[model samples]
Target: MKVVKIGGSVFKKENIINLAEFIVKNYEPYKTIIVVSALGRSPYPYSTDELINLFVEFKQNHSNGNNYLLDLSKSFVVSCGENIAAGLLSFAINYLNPEFKAIPLNAFQANIITTDNPIDSDIITIEIDNILRLLENKFTPVICGFQGVSKSGKLTILKRGGTDITAAFITKLMKANEIHIIKDVDGLKSAPPNIIPHCITIEKCNIDELAEATMNGNPVVNPEAINILQETNAKIIIKSIFSEKFTLSSKEIVPTQLVSNISNKDNITKFVIYLPSQMKNKTLVLDKVLKEIFENSISLDFINLDVFNNLASFIVNNNQVEKIKQILDNNQLHYKTMGRLSKVSIIGYNMRGKPGIMYRINKALLNEKISIIQAQDSHISISLLVPLKYLATTIKALHQEFFEDY
Candidate 1:
């Protein structure tokens, strides 16, 4: 079995026909399922954002302005885009192969059950027997992504990039042999091709490396989707829909491993806010502080809260420091600042049980007389906070130690 997700960017009329032909030609032997996203950037009347905006305007102008009604209405309205795309693709497939059957299925029909968050719902249960029945009868099930039905039967939409999540969930549920995410780009690149000179395309990477890149603002794929893939045995192929000579082969994500030289040099500022150690209700204070910070449109990074010392430290961009300071001052919080710091991370999926990885990283940086202010590690990544002056050196030294051909 195979699950293929066609991205919104490549859901044009001609592209849909081409995709149908490609699947019929190559995947005839397998039970294939197609997932489609809304049409992208075309002069379409019902893009997701436009649908939401239209619903809000209509509600404000015509309805009683109830919040529940607004959310419910928005969910139903925005889902139309995916439904249209799915229906169109199913039609194209059936047209191309008259002997083959293609069926368009919405979330309700496919049994994608979720929580009632309306805008960004969490999938609770997905009944797959109906999908299996379709495949058994030699039908191609074209599913509308990014939309699902709540337990209470209310229409709910997943977060933006939810189609990727939908595909991953289905792939895991069905234990599909492979997943192909058709997108506009060639594949994941080492860096943004337009910004970084001579950036190379990454042909293979584990889920950890992909997640690290996604978290560091690389828009190759959805982080949530990658999280789902981490639990499955399926290998994902991220390829361009424009490519005619692409292979179905994929780079599998190995467990407890990491790949090196993945670095983000963006300047970030670290703030350590001190709370009164004797103060009760620390949770309340922390929540209020964080709420204010988020309201200012400032995103916190590398956050660490030490409840024992009542110290909360986090990093933010230089541009958000002044606003953060004003919020702290207004709340009468005492804090210390560390500016001009850069985050260097070595990411891999196999770094979890491995020994001496940190020791080697420390030795490389120490040899250069670079001071490491702070370090954070996950199962797949070890991130260091160093001075901006050592950013390039740190990346080069770590890359040489971990990724260089020896």
Candidate 2:
């Protein structure tokens, strides 16, 4: 059996029928399961974001504090995108290739059981009985992606880009022979191609390496889904929707390059807290600040500490800028902010014990007239914080030094 996941970008009028043809022609031999995402960008009535606009307008006049009714309603509407796609694809397949039957299955019929969270859900279990029965009957099951039902029978939705999770879960539990994720791009690249045109396609990589390398911002694979598949033997094959070439995920991966990929997170707000030199117990005070941030549930990244200078700093998404200020002000902690910042990161396991990588990074940025604001590293990754204006130049410079030769 083969499980193929079609991305939302391939759902436009220009290509959908072609996609159906490709699926039918390429996957006709296998007992297949097709998972579908919401239609592409908005203005189209059935697109996921447009569906959410329905709830957003309703919530404006009938505002209620966070509650199940509001969340449940939003989940139902957004989940409709996948539902529509599933039905449409099933119909398309049946029309295009009459000999091969394609059946659409909703969350209940597909038995996608998830936790009680309505807006952002996690899959708890998948009963293969129904999907298996369909395959045995010479039918292909087109299951709605990014949605499941809670034990209480409430409609629930997964995080955005979660269709990847749905495909992996089905393939793993169903013990299917292959999992193919269809995207419009040419496999995975070291960086966003638009930003760094010279970026090379990554032919193969370990799941952990990909996740660490992408920690700056890319999220090439759904993190939770990657975690679920990390222990399994299944290989995730990412291919362009209409092409045969692909990037494969492997388990026993060895480092292939000094640096495998580079990615950047833009519009980051960095907060730096410096303790008074005369203040006693500086370590204790720094600990308190960190504890408060954690208790308040403010997620941060790229943390740096200078014990001798009694300074600590970290970056958070721009959306949380206000929350950070509130926490700092209420706690009476003095701090400074670097707004409109970006963090460029290089990720690779082969970098450990290697010399000149950091020197090369600094030289590259210096030559491009890009100043590094702050820097941090782990065994496999190096994150350099710089002004947002210099982001493009930083990525290009680093890519040239590390990947152009590679």
Candidate 3:
């Protein structure tokens, strides 16, 4: 069985029909299970600030339209999940050229249980077991992507791009042949194209490399879903939904050798605040300070408190240092010391298991007078911490070393 995940960005009505046609015309020989996401039905969900504003708007004007709008936001999430399944099913039989029979799968009665709060959820097993039985019967199952019904009988939405989790879960439960995720983009890129215009596409990526790339902030598949795929040994492929054709079975989809020089540099600003760790109502003071910082749109980088040593340290955006200093001075806050920091992460698949990569990188940074505060390596990337002032020099040196030719 081939399990396919269609992303929300490609979830338009016309696109859904085209995808169905492509699948039937190309890959129908293999039994396929499809997973769909909610991003298709609405604009991306609100961010932390936007959600707060949405709530505030509701409070200011308590009207039926506002209430309906809020409820619709919730409903759109559920609908996106359901319609992806329903839309695919409807298109597969009625619209596609060489149409195949599609069996619409609903979580309502099936044990597909989830949590009430859409933010965090836990699934029940009995429900999963029942769903697996249907797939085992040679029936094509269309499952919703983001929303789930919890054990407590509450509706819950998965994290952003969470359809990947649904796909991985189904693969483990049904033991499908492989999972294919089709999105608008052809495949994962070395970096976000917007930031790095010269970024190249990756032909093949390993699970560990994929996860590390995501953790360092490029959106591919969610890192959590990658873990599940690794655990179950499920073969996975990510491709474009807008493609003209699809392969008939897992064997037809091949993995190729592909690598590209990539660089992603985080723009950093930092501020440091140091204070005695102990004082009466210290916790309350810190809370108020953090609230003010956040309210001013100043994001924190890292914070450490040493009670025994009677010291506290806060690191934030470098550009916000002046403002933060003014706030502290106005409040008559005294501190022992403060400083700024910056970080740069290098991401690539071929970077692992090699000696001296870190050594060479560090030496280059030192040659440029960029002092390293801390450094760490992962399967796909190296994260280096340094003074904010030298962030440009650090990125330029590293890029020259690894990507100058490209």
Candidate 4:
């Protein structure tokens, strides 16, 4: 079985017909499942965003200011977009190919069970047997993406851009051979095309790199989709739906048992908070500090809390140190600061039991005369803090040593 998720950007009528024809021509030999998003942006009244906005306006004008009712109404209203898309696409596919039976399925019809959040529900389970029965009967299932049924039988929607999550979950549940996410772009690029003049399309990437890229603001796919892919054996392919020369040779995310990628994080400041041994109410003080950190919108890059030793160390961007210090001083806590550091990491899932990997990294940096201030390693990554001036050199040496081929 193969799962293909058609994105909202290509949700035009002509595009839907084209997609239907394309599926019949290309996927005739396999059991195929199609998932479709709501229609494309503006000019399409049934687009997800437009539908949500329409609900918001209606609630403001007519609702009694009840939060729960508003949320429920929003879910019901927003889900109509996907329902329409599924119905239209199913009809198109059936019209284009009478021999192949195509049927539209909503969250309730498809038996997609999710949390009762109404607006941003997470899938709890899906009725795999029902879908299998449809396949057994030679019925092509056109599932409405981004919608689900709550345990209480209420309509719910996954958050925005959730069609990817739907596709990923269905692929995993069906144990499909692969998942293809049809988009408007050619494929994933090394960097944003407009930002990097020479950015090239990456034909292949692993889940770790794709997740990292997504976190660093690369718009490839949903991060939740990548998270799901990480736990499953399913491969994800990104392709262009608009290209006439579209082929299966687009960007692919295959399973990599272990892979490494380089990450450069600059403008870091490390803090060491010293406390008396057996300090009373340590938890309370720590909670207060954490509350202040969050209230100020400071993001911690690294943190280590040693309650037994009466020490707490954390790393944040240099710009946030002054505000953090003010909070600590106001609370009469003693701390020291190491200002202006950069964190470079070799991120991989295979570094845990791999002997000498850390040694090679340390040796390479030493050879470059780059002193490491602090080093931290998890099963997934090895991170080092160095002087800001040495960051570029450290990244170069490490990238050359570990990820040259990548």
Candidate 5:
């Protein structure tokens, strides 16, 4: 079975029907399931301000010992559900192309149970499996994405950009052959086309390469989706639905090549602060001072503490220089923002296992006037944190030095 997840941006009333017809025509010999996110034709109409207002009202009602906020949240969630169902059904019946069975996705049968909190929900694989089996008798199921009802019968919603997660869960449970993630773009590219005009499409990329690219801010697909694919060993092809040409090629797109081809505006330079173990309890002082510095409005990512050794590391934006110093000075923490910090990642299954992998990576960076501040070795990736300013230079230099012919 092939499980296909369509993106919200590519969602069109006509496109949905068009896609259904195409899938039935091409893969009708095999079983296929479709999952759709609430984007495009039936977009969630609630504005940010309205969502916030509803959230606040819910909170106030809870504090005042009333169920009013709970009721409001449920109503709003149902409205979203209705829009999703209506759009999908309308697309199936009215907009679909000639010669295919067009069936409306009954909202009640789709009964996705979520958590009480509309903002969060968990995937009950059992429920999902039952739903899939129910569809086995007849009909290609179209599920409402990003929203579900919990076992307790409360409506819950998935996080933003969570349709991938839903699709992944379905794929893993079904043990499907491949996942076709149809979006607006042609496939995963060597780099953002606007930045590297010469960039070409990637015909083949292993789990390792996808992970490294996604972690480094590649725009093709979400990293979490890649991680899930790794665990399930399920193949995923990210392709553009609008493209007319359909040709499959066998080319191993090198990881280092892709890494060197890209540029990201949000490249983060992390600062890992190692403090004495005894100072862990005294974090109140650091916390107070850090709060004052944070108020200056610098964006912070992944502020986490190591329980074992009382270490804290936070990722900060590449451009926030003044704010970094302000936080350091006010806290009076003995620290140094290591100047030589960049991320050099290696992604390949065959490139796995040699005692000298780290040695080779470190030696290459060292020759390029780069220093490895911290190194993390995962199953298929070796990420080295190096100097921020020299990141691009070091990655390109390393690509040419070690992986040019790979």
Candidate 6:
């Protein structure tokens, strides 16, 4: 059996018939399951983004102010996209060829159980019996991606862009041969093509390489999908529905680049939480400050909690720095901001257990006279916090150092 996940990029009324034709032509004789994302970003009524906007407009107009109800209704409202996509694709497939018994299935009907979180929920369990029955009856079961039902029957959507995880889970649970992730782009690239004029499309890479390239704030594939299939052996093929050119993601074939990809984002701001030595329970105060930050919906990254030094720091989107400042000032907390920062990131499986990777990164930036304000590294990636003015030069330097041949 094969699991094909059609992303929102190509899951639309304009392309549904063509995709249906392709599905019927290729997998007519096999027990195939399809996971579909909402329609691509358009003015279309049922795209998840549009539906989310609709929900926002409703909230703004009505002023319901009920967090629980708004959350529940928002999830229910957004999930309608996948529901429509599944049904439309299933019908198109059947309409294209009568022999293909394509049947649309919702999360609840397909027995996909998830947590109660309306906006971002985890899949708890999935019973394959219903899907098995449908396939045994020679029906092509098309499931709405990115959503499942809680035990209480509340419709729960996974994290934003979670349709990929839905497909990965299906591939693992059904023990399918492989996963075909159909997207608009041909395949993964060494760098954002627009940024790096000479970048090349990566032909094939290990799952880790693919994850690194995709996870660095790129919207190619949901990182959660890679995490779900960590133990899975299924070959992952990412291809554009419009062309046969693809990137084969396996466990063994790591990327050839020492640093596989360069990722950067603009308008990031650094924040520091100062814990005064005289303050009793400095740790507790830090915790309270962090709690208030989260409560105010201030998301952050690159958190450096220096308990010994009685200080804590992190980065947040620049737009949120004002709000963060207000929260800190209102709580009478001591903090400071390093605004107008940018993040430059690089990742490679080759860097695993290898020394001097940081030296190379530092040397590259140092040669270019770019000051790295702060830096962090894990087994797979190295991230740098640099001034926004040096962002372009930093990327050029890193690319020249790490990917000069390209």
Q: Write the per-residue lDDT of candidate 4 for residues 182-257, one digit (tens) a residue.
A: 8877666543444333434555666666676554335567878878867777667777755543212212434243
Q: Would you give me the overall lDDT of model 4?
A: 0.77
Tens digits of per-residue lDDT for model 2 on 1-406? 7789888877765677788898887887337889998887688788888998988998898896768888987898788888888888888888999766888888889999999999888899888899888888888899998999899988899878778888889988987766777877656678878788767778887666666754567656666666767757777777886666677776767757777778778889999997778888888877787798898878889787887887888999999899889888977779999899988889887888888888889999989888788888888889999998888888888888888766
In model 4, the clashing pairs are none
Clashing residue pairs for model 2: none
Cα displacement (angstroms), candidate 4, residue 46, comes to 2.4
Residue 257 Cα positional deviation in candidate 5, in Å, after optimal superposition: 9.3
The predicted structure with the larger TM-score, 1 or 6, is 6
- TM-scores for all candidates: the values are 0.75, 0.92, 0.67, 0.69, 0.65, 0.87
Span of 10 residues, lowest total lDDT, candidate 6: 211-220
Report model 4's TM-score to 2 decimal places: 0.69
- Model 5: lDDT equals 0.58
What are the lDDT scores of the predictions, listed in order?
Answer: 0.78, 0.82, 0.60, 0.77, 0.58, 0.83
Best lDDT goes to which candidate? Answer: 6
Model 3, CA-based lDDT: 0.60
| Candidate 6, 29-61: lDDT as tens digits | 338899999987757778888998998898899
- TM-score top scorer: 2
- How many clashing pairs in candidate 4? 0
Candidate 1, 1-406: lDDT as tens digits: 8888988877766577887777677665228888889876445565676777778788778887677777888898989999988888778777888555888899999999998878889887689999998888878898999999988888899998989989989998999878888887767654445544444455666655776767765666777887887788787777875664232223464532245325564678999989998888887988999999878768887889887878999999888889999999998989999988888777766677889989999999999898799988877778889998877777767766765542
lDDT-wise, the better of 5 and 6 is 6
Better TM-score candidate (5, 6): 6
Clashing pairs in 6: none
Which is superior by lDDT, 1 or 5?
1
RMSD each, Å = 5.3, 2.3, 7.2, 6.4, 7.3, 3.0
